[model samples]
Target: MSNIGVVSSCSCIHPLVHLLRPSIQKKGLHTAARLAAKDYYEVLVLGGGTGGITMSARMKRKVGAGNVAVVEPSETHYYQPIWTLVGAGAKKLATSARPTARVIPRGVEWIKSRVQELNPDKSCVYLENDKKISYKYLIIALGISLHYEKIKGLPEGFNHPHIGSNYSVHTVEKTWRALQDFKEGNAVFTFPNTPVKCAGAPQKIMYLTEAYLRKTGKRSTANIIFNTALGGIFGVQKYAEALLEIIKARDINVNYKRNLVEVRADIQEAVFENLDKPGVTEVYKYDMLHVTPPMGPPAVLLNSPVSDAAGWVDVDKETLQHKKYHNVFGIGDCTNLPTSKTAAAIAAQSGVLDKTISLVMKNKLPTKKYDGYTSCPLVTGYSRVILAEFDYNAQPLETFPIDQSKERLTMYYMKADMMPFLYWNGLLKGYWGGPGPIRKLLHLGLK
Candidate 1:
């Protein structure tokens, strides 16, 4: 029972009542303070990225506008997948961003605070300024983090000319500058050893660079090189074979099992360590360099009770629900889903998660399963893209009937133009849920 209930039920002598009055008032003040520090919502989403915003919008519809809240610090929400084109000078960076206020579903509370700690067991998250936000259900959409500093002479190396990374918003424009200023010699690109969002982005920029050099009549003088940590070009066998053919046709150098370890930006030198042979390293001088730095889970997830040993959110791969906590869920690049991290995957997962949450709310089992659908619009050139779509088993799950392995301008238009429109108008608004329905419709239910 509450203090008020005790006080109302009490029937004591005047002297006893007077003595107890002081203690009761003190207790009341303490309770008030605790209440003031805390806020509650029916649903609390923990990120402002693609997944978080999308889920929040969906949750607002299921619950009510006033019942949902989102905790995010960023003032600007970026359509990050477009950054690959932005870096290649195909799209402007400004077009890829929007004010967070504009994207967050109206009437849904935006906490505008960074998450300090997640106490799932307590059903609360601690934010900056000792603020406590409790929720009946929690959604973790905190995205992956890039570690450019992990590589020697880096984030700082980005300060130097002719070196840039598409992975970062700050340096994406610099990639365009470097490509435009390239005179001759080696134009090198790297794929890190760590799991990165859009695993194909590193090489996508390389292909654009090669195409750009050729268009500028500098291809004859420039030597395009791709130093990747992976043994193969791409994960899916069909797409890998297609990309290999493109590499050969472009006359690009492929140094497999090599990971960039350092950069000497002052002298334009890049160092790579052979992943197969631990300490064996190689150095190359470059006129232009694109570094895809190591990526990992966000810092707050490290040593967190809600995360796995790898620091990723521990969630069921099919339902996207917390493996241990029934009321907690995870989405996007933050979860250990054993699949490529891409916005397309999030779109598909969002639909399944929505169904799962709805069922859980009604005390029923989740029957809808996520097939780990993901896509990579491998931009092979300024006008061509190999649309690679697949599932968790690394099997091709193409949306179109035509060969997705072949580079096509139509796919490029979808990646560069149509997708952004869908993202802003459909996905973020909780309308788009990937190409699954369309795939089934096109295949006449036979696929």
Candidate 2:
């Protein structure tokens, strides 16, 4: 457990509360100092994203209020899944965000700061503000780091009116703006060589743009291209088959094993290197360019002993517990879990971590397991979606009885309408699972 004196008997406020509210700095100075001397938490979460919020709520219910603490720096939290829709003009960017303070669990402490160091041996994390916080157990859900600089022209390319990306809440609306202005030429979308938070998002906007083009009578004038570094259209075989069919039927170009390496913004040109053919390079002109930047784990965990060489937290794929530290666990894009990173995957992971961490806190072996359940609602158009759900094996462990590989309006409505409600009201509020129960119920109790 944590150092016993960290829990105050008078106001019961944590040192982190003082970090935010300055009024407490004077009134609770002594109290804050006392807490600073110990600075311990029963359960400390390292992010305020979907997974961390879920953990805070779940832990509060299990261990009671004020026992959990979350270390995060952001004032606004984005429901990032909706960003694709935002770029598509189906959803507004404003609707994707909420204040972080308003959403964290009722009695949980919020430390608004970035982490600088992790000391697993002492169960402590060092913050950029020069404060040390200790925990009995730790959960990492810091998510993927977007390396926009790795790409040659990047944000500098924003000077070109047609260039935008859905990864940033600020820039995603620009994609819709660019599409709305397009008279036509080349509309290029690229998938990076690195693992991204939502693997399908790079192309989701492409389909939306294509649909917009068709609706606006510019489909015949614009050449839509999907240049992916991967050898295939998608990771899952079944979904890949369906997507390829859609591509051929739509006459969209697929340049497999092609990676975007540079953006010549002045000329409205993008450079692509052939992954399979190393020595060859091609430059293509674009009227509109959507780029997906290279992604990796956050720099805080880069050289830490808790992380793998690739900078992801090293955890058991099944249990999500740190390989070297039983009290340390991981969830979401930060973990080297060998699955597509998405909010939907985090939803499944939250369920497993809630059960496993409870057992670990009680000095019991965790019997709960995560099956690498993940879902990607692949939006093919303004009103069609191919709902891809699968497991660790990449097999089609679909939720609905109907062929989910096929594009349908119902799936689009689920993605566009139902998912945002579930995220805000259900998942972040500490529900035990994702769509598992509903999937099972729909399947007549079948696994």
Model 2: per-residue Cα lDDT over 4-73, one tens digit each: 1100000100112111212111111111111233488888888888778888888878876577788877
Candidate 1 has an lDDT of: 0.83
Query: Candidate 2, overall lDDT?
Result: 0.79
**lDDT string, candidate 1, 262-316, tens digits:** 9999999999999899999999999999988888888889989899999999999
The count of backbone overlaps in candidate 2 is 0
Error of 2 at 258 (Å): 0.9
Off by over 4 Å in 1: 1-38
Q: Which candidate is the best by lDDT?
A: 1
The predictions' CA RMSDs to the true structure, in order, are 14.6, 8.6
TM-score of each: 0.91, 0.91
